[model samples]
Target: MKRIIFFGLLFSFLGLKAQEQATISGELKKWHKVTLDFVGPEVSESDEFNPFFNYRLNVNFTHSESGKSYMVPGYFAADGDAANSSATSGQVWRVHFAPDEVGVWAYEVQFRKGKWVAVSDRDTPGVSGEFMDGAKGQFMIEASDKTGRDFRAKGRLDYVGGQYLQFQETKDYFLKQGPDAPENFLSYVDFDGTFHNDGHKDHLVKKWEAHLVDWKEGDPTWQGGKGKAIIGAMNYLAEKKLNSVSFLTMNIVGDDQNVFPYVDYDTYDRFDVSKLDQWEILFEHADRLGLFLHFKTMEMENQGLLDHGGVGAYTKLYYRELIARYSHHLALNWNMCEENGDWVKNHKTPPQFKYERLSMAGYFHDHDPYQHHIVIHNGNMFEDILGSNSMYTGLSIQTHHEDFHLVHPWVIEWRNKSVEAGKPWAIAVDEPGDAQHSLMPDKDDPSHDVARKNALWGGMMAGAWGLEWYFGYKHDHSDLTCEDYRSRDAFWDQCVIALDFFNSLPFWEMQPADQLIDNGNYVFAKPGEIYVVYFKTGEKSKLDLSAAQGELEGRWFNPRSGDYLKKTIKVKGGSSVELTGPKKDDDQDWTLLLTKK
Candidate 1:
């Protein structure tokens, strides 16, 4: 509270005027990391930028020595059609600032109107350089003054009568390792066929050991019968701090209990429907690794048809038996099912199916004496199918065909709807593009490109738990087979690369926002006091960030060379920013982290 008051007092003392000073307004906290957008209603049909109401702006600010300007990272528009009564929208003017220096500063925005100009303040050439006088180092410009009074290039002056505030600059922010620490930008990897007990050639364990770790098998028996494999995988994961083992199912698929009657199981007797005492070892082993088991009560596509031999009743008895058995263990989530949609759709009309599924879900929700969180995996991405259902606790949409950049918009949509419906939301993607199915051309595969993009952007915008890559016998897509257990882990090569990409980001519990600067490429930006942009499609695109106001510091990194490219840039107000870099390569990706300096 003291800190907030101190900053507020400092700002108040910077300057004062009649409430009608030039105004610029934006949210203090950005959805993503880059640009702050102030959305206002559009009021006219005038095309400022020729056909569209576009106004170009050049933002100039005091840098270390002279002045500096750089292109903002996203899209901006003032829509005149957005007005219901007095509300109007369109690109009134664009502003961009790359402050190389910090402290109290004043800057001016030059706006060039196209076809129509309403007020003289917006119709002019250069506007007053309002003093946004007190900020730290290297952050995005977001603060604004209340008064909306400024000048135009042709000497036309307009008074906005204390409506909005002008944007300010950015500062340097650091992180700590505690709960309130800076943030845990993450690095995640999907160790599917690579490190499992089935043991394929583990490339990551040998080559990129510095950047890779073992992922816990979904269940103890999921590791296969090779006891050494379990120890080896655990040792490796613990060494790398890959400590969280989600979906730690104790029941061995195809072994313990039969999910489908078609397959026979040697360990079918191991289920011991009468007692759960046998499962303690699995939970104990996970606890020994400093790991939390994201225990899923059931896997997907396994629940038998309700009418088939009364399996539904048997399944309910099993859940009751299990929950009564293992509900006391420390788990991450009471995972309802790997694919929750099958349950809802199949069980929709039947009282037994619907009621049992709903009842089980409610048991986890209401009667879990352990107070654990309930998270269910849904098939479809739209909230109506999964989120709107009474059984769902949070939302997890597997990214099958979508690119990583779409995570932000999806999260925004989910959050807004959840708020309206009065529910707390969680956004997670356990699967992205299928690992086996390369969904792209050799160099032009949008799917492959989106796969990597999804890993990064998912964490950035959706606040995802991280993405999962499915790996098993290509033929055993549905169930595990003994033949599927190979000593060779073929996909570790890509997994190592993906993990490196994840670790390279800053992903500690970042929130989502509706604020955006759409550059029209795969690149969509969410700016806070800092800016984070995702360039998908593996293509270079141009962005008009003239409306962006702040000091900027960023670099382009060659993911292949592991080298950072330093370039000096100054964005003109409302002008398009041209991006240059490699277009396509498996490892050819770049990240730009800009803060107002």
Candidate 2:
């Protein structure tokens, strides 16, 4: 009888161990997403137990060599293959980790259950779950085999105390240029959700049929090939050399009213698992294709929808899920809101005060192990949030001008103001033009001269990191309705030209030195190293090199054609030098690049 009892206890211990096993997947490489899927308690989206809010899955990943560690939050994944299976209930709890170093990574899982345990700050607020609560494992990561434009080769993009974000591994600064329109890019019909038939602006659901031709043979798709067009859209952007794409993740009650991560339009706490898994496929493809994700969490119209403009349980859960699921990506930012904090005077929505913004940012700061750069789009509170102590690391500028003239000065204004406030921001002109006709199609304004001179070069020369074109509502493929990115193909080429020129220089170390030029042009310089002078009117300008001590090689670049004039000049330092564009097209916009010789 004693021997039989001992064998029974040993069998029970083995069963418990099997239940606690975690399956690790993905490429075991540095900077690659290594996913850990655990078999935990089974729960449906509408379960009374509240899988999203009541359960917390936190995994501690530590690099064995450096002793570096990260406590990454995990979520209920629903059957472990929900993207394809579309299962509503399962025991698969998961965490995604992008390992930064090439070595052994040890991970320990801590699964807890209680009321609002997901957002709770107490160290031991809840009791441990049955399965995978203390599961532990280790994996070896090799050097990333990816190269070229794939972000896995570059590592995480970190805001390293400057006006630009740098890749952790490559130490390369990023300059983004992509489409900012059709903000409801995620409101697709292919995902497992009722939003398509919810009847809340259902007509805005995008098929992305126009980009289907861009999809390659090996690209990922879900629910038996339902995500081709959207995946193809990402391919198109990467092919065009545009490195960023912006979309509203949740736009309930906002413009278009078609995007949200919930199981239903109004379900705040419960998330649609399969739908988000499909989004992960697209976002993962974006990372592989070198596209930066601009996750505009909320827009002005629906900023008050969650917790009525406070960082309460609903808001906390919303952000927690977002960070848990998508924050592992290498190149992305948590844009707090689009046109944030506008309810101060309008009173149409509840006010999101400075404290609330800080609180939200504080949550991301504490929860996100990567500590990704956080930003807020302008509405009315940029001035109020400017300071070193402020949590925002950047600004998304929107200029409501018919012409692109304001793009330059607005970027300069905020860049200077942020610096004066003791916190320099990575400013980008996201919406350079007005709501009606910002960037017209090639059929209308094929030349795109004003946009090139005033917006593209204008913003960049003012030390703005980059610009994303917003298609005005009056034009074809407007912001809310753009399905085809080809509407602005020609303009994208212009953006590529600007990016290529800037990439060839040490732009991260340069600052806006407009005072060094006598003409009404723009100047960006690193003093004695290099100088980039933009002539908006293609006129010659006298650049002051009086503070330098060497000769500089000068080359005139035609911004329109993306070419060097071949005719180069040598200028002496310690004096002002007159610089001219190429004589062939001297009347058009040109950029003068001067490097120390």
Candidate 3:
């Protein structure tokens, strides 16, 4: 049964003639965005390209089958040929709408024209004029048949009152395993923007050389095949079974001035439509490959770079364009800032700056019909709005040590704390620290002791949704500059093993229960049925089995090789059993699994 409740704006569409001048494109599948392109007045390069000023497209789409409706907004798509053409002006204005119901979705377009048109309501008379008003059309959306890496097959990842993110289609919980470094992940050479590492904030330049060979046939690109390198990089990650990557869409005042979507870094008002379209192609490919786009919207240095600490002109347009263009993605979150709290120059962003963040995140929550997860990366303090009443639904944390045991407590704190405050917060240890040398490449740290025992297993056993390994700054592909993911293949293998371990078990129903161990070890359990324990530094212990009524069995798991090292050891109920480490790798780290027989 489908549950329907009002969120955002809902309205009925007024039908118009069967044939309109506008063109509709994209897959007609439920949750898949349908693009509506219309002809508008052509402006010259000299004319300021301001959708916020010159024009507005307010489209209301209604599901014919269920009578459900969504008032989706559209934007200015340069020439409708942005991927192949960089024309300053052409009659191509488009609106992208993701239908929630699989049926004939009818839509009506109310295109208004005026100066500063984007600043007010649809009916507000701000230098009023009518452009493509009263335009109407309908499209059929069928059920999707995408699977494997395709998020469409898996469904939308939503924050549904749990410590984990549950897939809307499968209703299964998602466990993330991916990269969190190469902060300038979007500064690809094929992208439209200027780049200067300056050898200060970053020393390594980016060309995405290693994955060039990975670009196979059928992949997309912009003008003259300019997007292969970046798209291929995503392909490589997906092939490696990694499902996520974090990149800054804008980094003007930070490390690298190479990836902003603006026509020019200094000009935030006007976007580089061609470049953004190219990005959209890559994003679509990533979605099909089952990779989550972790869009880190802002870096620490410039949290207040937009509108001088207030949410206004530039900030509004930036977020509006981002939502209008990419909110349709099936799996993603609009992270307000990377390492968020007041990283502005001189004095910090004033106390009033809190309202700006509220406004920015609130805009996405209220405007985006999809309502994707909203989170903020760590800054100097715990997020101020981690509650049920706040707009934030999750947290992207960063730490400062090689030992990730901190991962466990922090995750427990946020998850339990937020739920107590009324909403369960999905916790992801995106960056585990000592940033100078965090999760080094496989070559730099062969054992990966701290990361595996502390960060990966610790966080998961503590009910964390998942973890993303951040490359330390000391390595060749540190946080600021990473082009080749293969350098961390060994570590990636460990992550795969960890995720595989959790997926094979009913980990979702379990919670951290460390009190059952006599020795210093980690445990996650469902009390009377299933339990998992991790032994660090070859520690031994007696697992208390009093809660379990039936005879209990145990198996020793090797974190490094993803294999079972020992057969089941049965212990009588209401008794304690001594658990040992791996038979041969006795002094090394290991994990144990227990379940009632």
Candidate 4:
């Protein structure tokens, strides 16, 4: 509170407003990020680009069309020349804005210069910086016409108090299918402050040379044609029908120190604009290719590794920069921390650490202009953090054990708990199986029978929002070092089948009902209108569809082959129906669908 007050007191001494006016830069498209440059008092990077203190500039934008308003904090761009040139000295300061509305939007700027470590408001007797204190500007935004794989066409995906994420514009519920392998997935050579020859936390080294062929004609590249391999990796995933990928934006003290936005390994505040600029290109391509970016902020060991604890000045600066630059993206979520259980050493009390994490989430939730979904990877401990008042909106879980059977009960438990707390949480099995041997390559375990039954079908059948495959330590590509996405070639087909099955049905309308199943199988139905059941045992059993009214048409779906029986089976209303086992035998997994006829 003292710190907040100190910053708030320095606003009164701000110098008289100068005649200079501010200008808006970049394209002005609805749902696009815009930069407003404030050319004022000259300040250079050598003078300390540290935004923790001294001076601060903030901006507020209001939509003229609908009267919507968004107030966001700003940062000094170190000459505002970092993107094109490395000039460390200049008079330009900038703020980024992403307008969600069309038509015209007006903005106001407030800049303060002080000798203190923190400054805000206009109360100090020593406030300075005359040129930008009262500047304002207006820009026009237009609708987007992009379609097909472009996620912008669908608009922002938000947590609308349900068990699933819904697109803001199209109102379509999303189910994610993609790779969660290679936790160090962002250690690309083309990125800033990265080394390709480095090894993962497991000490396994990979050059990612095998994925070079996957880089297509139109994929983006950086550092003057050096990003083909990394960008190509994304191309392959999109081609495989997968739509999401998880990677750490910063793991300086963890598995891979090769991926971060800093100018060096230790510095966290001065971001390398050129390197980050290249990243924006790839992310933009991912956007057009229809990919959901799951940004894992901090790994297990480094949760409290910062200068101050989790909610320190460094934390605030990092989150602010990330939100300002990338929050315009439509499909993505911020994983506050990955495996966030090892920070107990940093706090005087264990529970205090938990509150600190929650505090960070709360801070992010309140500041992020778009309010993107915020979740944290867990150590299976989410008791005090499951209520509607909490900042978390989903679950990013990690488990031990090869079969994903754990996913079913866990997701069901969290969903049930979140619902009981008045806000249903979107659950995704981020990392399943133990750290030793998680999801193996298709070449090693081509069938993937156990995984499909548990992690894929089990979680979804019990109401999960998404699933990402994790590679085990025993494989050629462990969770940290794996580069070739095609290593699990055959497993992708199974993922497609699961996602397709759900997409074909109005899954958003279906509710999980374990009572509707007579056998040990799973049941997802609208109660009376539609019934879809998963038969993991593939044994001939009776399904109690008696509560369902009217006659229904039934069919058998082959989970492995992605094929369904065309012929309809009769299911009379208010009566139990007998289901036959799959012709392939007891080892197979099959699904049954019955629609009112």
Q: Pick the TM-score winner.
A: 2
When sorted by lDDT, best at the front, the candidate numbers are: 2, 3, 4, 1
Could you tell me which 10 consecutive residues in candidate 1 have the lowest summed lDDT? 176-185
What is candidate 2's lDDT per residue for 519-595, written digit by digit as tens?
Answer: 77999999988988888765667889998788989898888889997889889999998877667455778788888
Model 2 — TM-score against the truth? 0.95
* CA lDDT for candidate 2: 0.88
What lDDT, from 0 to 1, does candidate 1 have?
0.35
How would you encode candidate 3's per-residue C-alpha lDDT over 1-597 as one tens digit per residue?
A: 122222111222233322234578888887676788877666542375556556667788898878998777777777788777866566677788766668788887777777667655557545433446777668889998676668888778888867778888888888888998788887776665434443333344477888889899888877877777777789888888988888889888887767687776567777777778878888898888988888888878777788865677678777878888898888998888888764743465456555366666787787777788888877655556866568888888888876665787888778778878887788788997677888888888888887887888888888887788788777788877788888888888888899899988887788888888866688899988888888885756888878888787888888989999647677676777777775754777778787888
Model 4, runs deviating above 4 Å: 1-26, 40-46, 49-53, 78-92, 115-128, 194-207, 342-355, 582-586
User: How high a TM-score does candidate 4 get?
Assistant: 0.89
Candidate 1 total steric clashes:
90
Which one wins by TM-score: 2 or 4?
Answer: 2
RMSD of each: 26.1, 3.1, 5.8, 6.4
Residues 1-597 of candidate 4: C-alpha lDDT, one tens digit per residue: 887455445433343333345657766777666888777777654356443346667678999968999877666665564544555556777777767788999898777776533333344424655677767767788887667878867878898887889988788999998888798887765554434443434243345677789888766665456777778888888988999988888887777677776666767666665566666677878888889999888877677766445577677767766776677788999998888875564434455444366787787788777788888887537887888789888888777776666888888788888889877788888887777766788888989888888888887898888888788888877787787888898988899888999999888778778776666788888878898888887677777777888888879898888898786687786977778664646657788888898
Which has the better TM-score: candidate 1, or candidate 4?
4
TM-scores for every predicted model: 0.47, 0.95, 0.92, 0.89
Candidate 1, superposed: residue stretches over 4 Å from native: 1-226, 238-279, 288-292, 304-317, 320-331, 343-358, 380-392, 399-416, 434-450, 454-461, 472-526, 537-548, 558-563, 566-576, 582-587
Location of the lowest summed lDDT over 10 successive residues in candidate 2: 346-355
What C-alpha lDDT, on a 0 to 100 scale, does residue 259 get in candidate 4?
A: 73
State candidate 1's TM-score: 0.47
